[model samples]
Each structure stands twice: as C-alpha cells, then as structure tokens.
Target: MTNHKLLIVGTVAALAILVAGGAYLSGRSEADRFAQCRTGNVAGGMEAFGTDFTLTRQDGARVTAAEVFTRPSLLYFGYTFCPDVCPMDTARNAEAQALLAGQGSEVQLVFVTVDPRRDTPEVLTTFGEQFSEDIVGLTGSDEEIAAVNKGWRNYYKANDAEDDQYYLVDHMTNTFLVMAGGATAEFFPRDTPAEDMARKVGCFLDAAS
Candidate 1:
C-alpha cells in the first residue's frame, strides 16, 4: 500500500510541474511584454532599446542580438579609420568594461561598422583587437549594413569627392546601451564616464533580471 501511495504522489507532482512550466513559458512569450518594452522607448526612442540586429564579431564570427539577448550589450557605430570620435568612444567603452568586471557585473560590448565599404571583415577583425579584447567588431555588405543601421536607428554618411584619398565616413558618435531580452531599456550618449556607465549597466541588469 505504501508503494502504491508513493507512486501516485510522484505522478501527481510531475504533472503539476509540467503544467506550471508550460504556463510560465506561455506568459513570457505573450506579445504584451515586448509591446510594453517597445512603447517605453518612443518618448526619446532608444534605438538600442529595440530588438533586431546581428553583426560580424571581431573574431570573424557572426553575432546575433539573440546570442547576447539575455545580457546587457553596449553598442557603438563607427569605422576603423575614424581619427578621433570613434577611438575616444571605444576607449571609454573599454574602461566601462573594466569597471563592470571590477564590480562583478556582466555586459557585452559591440562595435558596428558605419563605413562597411572600407571596414572590411579582415580590417575590422585586426583593428578591433587593438582597442579591447572584449569588444566585438562587426562589418557587412552595404545592404546588410544599411538594414541593421536603420533597425538600430544609427546614422552615417560617406564622402565621394575625396573618398579615394581619405576615409569618407562621418557616423554618429553616440553609444547605445541595450539591455538583453528587453528592448531599449536605456542609453548612454557619447563620452559617458566609465563609472556612471557601469552604474547604469548594473541597474539595468538588476532591474532587467
């Protein structure tokens, strides 16, 4: 009789567990959750806050937003030939990465090429390694670059007259702070202090979790 009772209890527990797990997954997939995340972005409209983008990583591997979708991602748009703004911003991002590491916070850094024409896969892979070990550089065909830029709300322009002599990219200098999973949680503009950037990322990760 004890064996019979034990078997019944175990079966009932398994059924309950399965039912609860299904419900939880269903609730998370509901459109409302993502919709709320999208609506919150419209006031100033955080471009990094939205969902959708996959770029080539610094190691010559393709990275999708889905890969880091559950982690915080700091995104920047620039080209390797950038003389000033890009380097300064990327350096700051590297500092932020170190700060986060010291604080035990998890974050991912992404660098998307604005001058894909010249920032080929080989150049980006080599140049990106010089900035930071954790920074991921991405470059793609012009059409692919344009689609991703629009999705992320990034801006870029090319100069034609002197294009052959010098790099012809003038991209936005702002850095995008994106929370994994939830689109457009917040943003840090160009030159945000490393300490402040780390704090914001911590808060976003905590709240997002």
Candidate 2:
C-alpha cells in the first residue's frame, strides 16, 4: 500500500476515535451534573429553597413546617426506599431532635422525599413518623417534585424504566435550617454530629430571639 494511503487511513481512524470520545465525555458530564452530594467545604451549607409547599400531615391535616413548628425548622431530604442513607439520615435527624429536646430547644424536624414515585403521600406519612412524631413527610406531583429538587439542588433519578419501581434519589444529605419567617439560615451536612447540630440550632435560636 502507498504511504499516502496509509496516512489517510490513520487520520480517519483517529477522527473516529475523537468523535467517540467526545460523545462519551458528554454523557459522563451530564451524569455528574445530575449527581448530588453533601457539602464538605463548610461545616454547614445552605439550602436551595424553591417555592414553599403546602402539604398534608399524616393525620390528613394541612400543614407546613412554619405553620406547625412555628419556632425554627430543620429539614432533611431523602426517600423512603433508601436502603441505608435515608434511614441513617432519619436516625441522625431523630438524634438531633432528641438532643434538642434534652436541652429544651424548640426546633421543627421535617423530612422531604426526593423520590416521590414510591414515596407517595402514604409512604411519606409512615416513613417520617417512624423517626419522630414531629417528623412530617410531604408529597407533590412530578413537576412539583422536580421543582423542589432543582430549588434544593438535589440529585435524583428514576431507577426503573417503568414508573412502578421505586426511584433512587441522590441529594445532598444536608439539614437546612429555616429560621424565623421561613428564611433559610444554615444547613448541617451528614457528616456533622447530631449533638453539634442541636447546639447550632440552640445558638441560632438564642441569637434570633
């Protein structure tokens, strides 16, 4: 074969590889963009609050964290089907609740489900109440769910091709604190200890009041 022909063939192969590489990279970047993880730089992070939601409690009564707790709010984002992280987060939230209770700190603990397909209103009702009586689980439509996720910068996706199977919600495991007047103040990541969170809440309340 002529050297010129060989060179042309090699160039064609390289171009093909470049194109394939570019496609792969694009897909990977999209995946990473959708991924959500806890904040590590600061001891506590901030909430990306979207539009406020009015949801019914387990008892079929309308409520919001602000309307119910009325003091300060600690919000946890997770789903019911979570095998490990969700339960751990709830337990940690409960621990924080207990710590605050021990200190007589009035803090509202709220749990929001990222995967609402399986974690319907009923699922949320049961899952949240297990941790603490104060814990409330709320549900909304897909659009509302997406809006909340975007507002909070949560990472989650449907696990199955069909809607029957539960979805996997990937979100920053941060407890957002909504101080007085439904304003977001600070947030505690999963790494922070429950005791520290309780203390922070106490301090915030003391300063606010």
Candidate 3:
C-alpha cells in the first residue's frame, strides 16, 4: 500500500480500538469502574471490612456511622491521651482533609477514641479542635466502642501499669477512607503522606462520582 494509504489505515485502527475500549468501560458496573482507584487489598474484601455502629459525638449526641459519614470521611481509631502516634496520625489526616478541601473536595474527619475511659465528649471536643473544628470526635460505652471496633476489625488494648492515669494504649494506626453509605473505600498506613492520601482519596471520589 502507498504511505498515505498506510497512514489512513493506522488512524482507522486506532479509532476502532478507542471506540471498543470506551464501550467496554461504559458497560462496566460502578464498582468495577471504581476498582481501578484501589491501592491496596483488604483481607476479606472491602464489602466485609466496615459496619455501622452508634457512638456519641463531640457534642454528646448519639450518632450512627451513617449519620457521621454523610460524605467521604477519614475514620481513625486512637486516643486523646496517646503521647505521640495518635496526634501525628490525626494531624496528617487533618492535613489531607485540608488539601482535598482546597481542591473543591469536601471530606469529613472522624476520630473514634480507643480510650473511651478518658476521652469523654468534652475531652474529645477539645482534642478535635486542636486539629480541625469540624472533626467529628466519637466516644461511647465500652460495649458500644467494642462493637464498633470489632466491626472495623480494629485492635487496641490498654496497658497494664501502676499509674492508670498516665498509662499508654497499644492500638492500630491505620486511617480508613469510608464512603457515605459506610462502605470502606480504602485505608492508609501510618507512614502515608498527606498529599498521597489526598490524591488517592480524590481518585476514589472521582471514580465514585
């Protein structure tokens, strides 16, 4: 074939491939389309990861996961008394939330204390304010907290110590990205940077939308 004919044939083939790919994507379900946004895998898959639970908010009002997670939310499990790790992790989440906000994406920050004994509504309200005023701080009875923890598969234990007031609690430091309907979209490791978390969350949000 002539060079002009060859060029024309190549263009037609490219267009055909593009059309086929677009059709394939359009035929996929919403979950399949958003699957590309996933960075890591959960043990039993995302559907089995998160569950709804009732807990008290910073304002001392009882609320459920569905109510607090009315939008894309960063859910964390930690304590106000945590000397180092919790503070750093929550600060990173706040930073990520701010980044998303600047890019026109609104996400809620949820802090569920593992040390409910010391993290009352008043204490949580003060702790949450140190990061973001809009942060949702949740605490509840031991049973309620345990149920929520079990639903999320969170591991936390209080240390055996002589001084109960100053004792530290051992807990997981992962931050979960939960969608509006209580579906856990993803999770970030303790070392994940704010920018990286924001970018991943943004990808998920875009895919979901």
Candidate 4:
C-alpha cells in the first residue's frame, strides 16, 4: 500500500510540472520566444521587425534594403533641419559606431531622412558629413519613405508652420541596430551611453565572427 501511494504522488507531481511548463510558455510574448529559422525572432505569432526597402542613396543611386543593410548597421530616422534632437541623437550614434570600431567591429551608420522634401541628396550628404564621412545618408520619394517608416514602426509628425517648407518634424529617436542578416536584432534607446551601446552591439558582432 505504501508503494502504491508513492506512485500516485509521483504521477501528480509530473502533471503539475507539465502544467507549470505550459503556463510559462503561454505567458511569453512571441518576440520573447524562439521560433523557426527563416525569420528572425518570432514574437506575437509573427516575425520580428526587419524589412526590405528601396530608396535613393545620398549618392543619387537607387538602393534596395538588402544593399543598405548588407552589413551590421545602425539606422536612425530624422530630418537634417531639426535644430536640436536629431543632431544630438545622430552624433551620439556616430560616437557609438566609433566605439565599436575601436573594438574592431565595423558597423555602418545609415541615416534616413523623414523630411524627404527638404533633405535632398546633396543636403543629406552635407548633413551626414558633419557627423561622419562614413555615414550613409538616404532620401526617397514620399511613398518610399512612408513605407519604410511604417515597416520599422517609426513615427514622425510634421508640425504646422506658416511656411510649410520649413516645418519641424517630430520623430521617434530610437536607434535600430540591425544584425548582418538584415533583421532588426536590437534597438538602443536614445539615452543609452556609447559604451553601453557598444557592449550590446559587440555581443552580436562577436557571434557573427
């Protein structure tokens, strides 16, 4: 009878373990969980945010997403005209890239303008040079810019100005660190220090090599 009681207890314990495991799995967000290999992380029952795009490079050539994201890249979306936030954020991103370079990881810094009308190729090229000559400044038609922005879950709003041509654009400032495979593997908040950002990026660069 003692042996029989022990078996019953063991069975109940096994069932409890199974229930707990199921609960843990069910509670996780899709992005928080791992899925098949074709896509990046699977979150919310869908692939995580990395997408392909075609836009005009600052050099006046049309480039596809794969071409731009060919290597590990830091993507920032803002207009060159911003008096403050965009410049500061972009400078910080450039600093992080320099930090990564110091550690032997070459990460491309690609700046995409949300204000395409005002940010022509020449304008973007000049603005980008102020940060780093290596930076790739991209501008596209309005439709192309909107599509890429939507895919990346980035937001920008043009504030009303008496002269619409000189309006201010309020945009999201998170820097997206896309892995080599063209998938948005990580994102660093605007406030993240260069050292901290480099440490996070190094993890991926290390693994890639």
Clashing pairs in 3: none
What residue pairs are clashing in model 2? Answer: 155-170
lDDT of each: 0.73, 0.70, 0.90, 0.83
lDDT of 2 by residue, 67-167 (tens): 65466778777888888987997888788888888888767677777766676777877787778877767666677667656665666766666645654
State the lDDT at 48 in candidate 3.
Answer: 80
Per-prediction count of colliding residue pairs? 3, 1, 0, 3
Compose the digit string of candidate 3's lDDT tens values, residues 1-209: 99999999999999999999988877766557668888767788777877778899999899988899899999999999998999999999999999999999999999999999999999999899999966999999999988898888899999947778888999998999999888888888999999999999999999888
TM-score of 4: 0.77
TM-score of structure candidate 1: 0.73
lDDT of 4 by residue, 1-209 (tens): 69999999999999999999988877763344322222233353223565688899999999998888879999999999999988998899889899999988899899989999899999999999899867889899899999889887889988856779778998999888886668776777788888888887887676555
Tell me each candidate's TM-score: 0.73, 0.70, 0.85, 0.77
Q: What is the lDDT of residue 191 in candidate 2?
A: 88
Worst 10 residues of 4 by lDDT: 33-42
Ranking by TM-score: 3, 4, 1, 2
lDDT assessment of candidate 4: 0.83
In candidate 4, which residue ranges exceed 4 Å CA deviation? 1-47
Please list all clashing residue pairs in model 1, or write none if there are none. Answer: 49-183, 49-184, 69-181
Worst 10 residues of 2 by lDDT: 34-43
